[model samples]
Target: MNSASSIQESRDEIVPSGPLIRLSLWVGDRNLPFWVLSIGMIVMLLWAGAFKMTKPGAEGIIPLVSNSPLISWQFKLLGPYMGSNMIGATEWTAALLFIVGYARPKAGLIGALITTIMFFITSTMLVSTPDATIAWKGFRYMNNLGLFLFKDVISLGVSLYFISYYGRRVMLDEARTDS
Candidate 1:
């Protein structure tokens, strides 16, 4: 018991219990937010997957192009692959794995990497295409609507935050214990 207390004292000496501890936990350290965000992303990805599996219509994330008077030629290169459902399915697999919190350090990195790519690709499309011109104007997005966009933004942020958190010894211990 004395040794344990000594260890605790040593730990306290380094971390110093206070708002910093809580803040770290909330943002990227040993907090539940990281897991919550990960699982949330997974659930949303699944929801999107279900949407694709169910009501696949012209008004979909990708099919919305038909509603407009003119479709861009640039999107042709993307074709069906750029469709909302297709992209959701691709991301769902990764997000689901991440949501479960297995190999979180690695999972965090993967989620961040994929979300980063998604952010860049979507932003680029929104900027280059006339249809998505609204997104270029400012904080606003293009014609694309729904929680999917919101989820992507959150995932991108959480993934980045978690990656930093995963660096801490606390995360390493968690990963090691789980393994």
Candidate 2:
């Protein structure tokens, strides 16, 4: 090989792979991925649920909630202000249960189920919320409402993972006890 070509090859061999590759490998670890997902889920739930507890934050979602047929009865019976409070309370309760899951497997399993249901309901907003689509770059696309609701897909996936993992753990414990 020519001197320049040999030097380039040597440099390539000595240098490490790109960070993205390294990160992919690191996250590919079975346990690490779950822990990362769990931490991210916890942060998102805590932050979002905390906001739901506040007046401004709770009020902001009124239109969306009111529009949803599945939940609009809450708005009607409780009224906007009180209904918002109730929704906030529900979110906060689910988030707290998820936090407790870290220490208690049974509690964690219930939290995971609650979280899964919450995300599933929110994800349905893509259909229930009005004007969920918009024209973007001459192509029809999800509007902000759709975009906001669509992120529940990730949350749903994470919740399912928690359910499967914790559910299995709980079941195994039960079986061991029975035996």
**Which candidate number has the best TM-score?**
2
List the candidates' TM-scores in order.
0.53, 0.77
Model 1, global lDDT? 0.54
The number of residue pairs in model 1 that clash at the backbone is 0
Tell me the tens digit of each residue's lDDT in model 1 across 1-179. 55647976786678547997767745754557756766676676677666654446313545334332243332354554355445666567666646543554565556556656655454333334445424454666545453334445555566566556544534567657999
Model 2 TM-score relative to the real fold: 0.77
Which stretches of candidate 1 lie above 4 Å from their native place? 1-30, 55-58, 63-85, 100-104, 123-151, 166-179
**Model 1, 75: alpha-carbon shift in Å?**
6.4
Give per-residue CA lDDT, model 2, range 1-179, as digits (tens).
66657977885686458998777655664578778887787778777877776788778888788888788898889887787777666666776776777777788888888889888878787888888888778997897778888899778998899999888778777878999
lDDT of 1 at 99: 58
11: Cα error in model 2, Å: 34
